[model samples]
Target: MVAKAVVKPAVELPVRADEDSWTEAELAEVRATLEAEMAALVAEIAHAESTIAEDGGGDGAGDDQADAGAKTYEREHEMALAHNARDLLVQCERAVRRMDAGTYGVCESCTRPIGKARLQAFPRATMCVACKQREERR
Candidate 1:
């Protein structure tokens, strides 16, 4: 069976970023993408936490050195995955907040419009390409 697509209400952005014009369709699409990604990331974080707990709670009494090391590695790997997911989740949340605050597509550093193409490519981006590159260099 085919899954039904969710119909999200169009986002009414009162503030446009600089000279860039964002249509209601574009804003709705971006909002949908961000919300979907956020949901997936939350699920991933929960799964990773469960995996880490299961792996770390085992007693090592019967395990040899290799087995112990492998379990430790798996637990650490899950922790890292969870950490990355958490970071992404934070970014998504911040983007949503910016959208609500009427500053979604504006570059935080340069106060310029982050191009629509860039935002379409990375919904969580808070800076334009130039500002991002400069930030990376610093």
Candidate 2:
């Protein structure tokens, strides 16, 4: 017996269907915001890494218990900050890729246009407000 091939529906491009979608000017603005955020995150990550490295070289040769504890705490704090910066940088990079692919300003989950106001407030968003709310609830 021959098996039937399953045909999937064609994916729709992220064309705007309503005023809620982004305008060209809005897209440009979002791009600029993402770029600025990415630059700041990169710089922050670099500084954190440098501070962590500089603090790691100490042998604690003459340090008291409190000094060692303080150094450890500071190093851990810098590491946590660097990790968060890296996460934000990755999100910014993904937003830029979506813009290039003509898929920006659309919700990833529902395939609907995200609201302009939401995008302006949070350029790293990949989903519409409703979808994001549902996700957060889950």
Candidate 3:
């Protein structure tokens, strides 16, 4: 007699359709948050650019060294902040796209509906907790 191998099916994720889906109020809140964050990032970028232009000036030897140090520090800090802002913007854009596609709170990895709490915290997560952990491990 040949032994039959049993295979388990992958877990099925829940889907929120129509009336069971995220409320209008929840979506409004997320939109508001994304807008606020985007605005702040834009302002920061503008300020950084202005500072950089102002800092680039000729001065005496001692003053030149100090200015160089200051400029370097400012450049590094601004670069980091700009990178962070750009990443956030990308995430916000993805969230908006998901909302339009009716997959806002769905995990991309496991095809499961992400919890409301997670959505509230992240607002841009593409994977559920379990799948996220699995991915990170690799």
Candidate 4:
């Protein structure tokens, strides 16, 4: 009988230090990144809303159904974009709150430390890469 090789999963990197161990500089960097993102998101949402509103206004130049349909489609697309931006803004704001609470960079699911690289790429990530991947697999 041939024995099957037992494969083990690769161990994830050790949990990075918690926020408590982080220097003021580290926390400040995250705070600044989150705040900047929030500001950008808010501005984007505002601009999208304004544009959508303007597009919805009937200039009375073309009262045809085709023009109305086209305008409707455009308004819908812009609203979707604004909604996505709003969601991102909420996430950024939540990250800021977590920073203030000294819980930023900690995975919400496994409670593991989210790596600095991941954090740098996505300052509002609430889950570590491993946990996020696992969640996606489900």
lDDT of 4 by residue, 26-66 (tens): 65776788888888998999999999888777775856999
| TM-score of each model, in listed order | 0.84, 0.82, 0.70, 0.77
Q: What's the lDDT of the predicted structure labeled candidate 2? A: 0.80
lDDT of 2 by residue, 22-127 (tens): 4566677778899999999999998999999998998999999999999999999999999999999999999887777667677999988876677779989899
Off by over 4 Å in 2: 1-21
Q: Which lDDT tens digits does candidate 1 get at residues 25-49?
A: 7887888899999999999999999
Query: Which of the two candidates, 2 or 3, achieves a greater lDDT against the reference?
Result: 2
After superposing candidate 4, which stretches have Cα over 4 Å from the reference?
A: 1-21, 59-62
What residue runs in model 3 are displaced by over 4 Å at the alpha carbon? 1-20, 57-67
lDDT of 4 at 68: 75
TM-score of 2: 0.82
Minimum summed lDDT over a 10-residue window in model 4 is located at: 6-15
Clash pairs, candidate 2, are none
Cα RMSD to the true fold for all candidates = 7.0, 7.4, 11.6, 13.3
Worst lDDT 10-window in candidate 2: 6-15
Candidate 1 TM-score, true structure as reference: 0.84
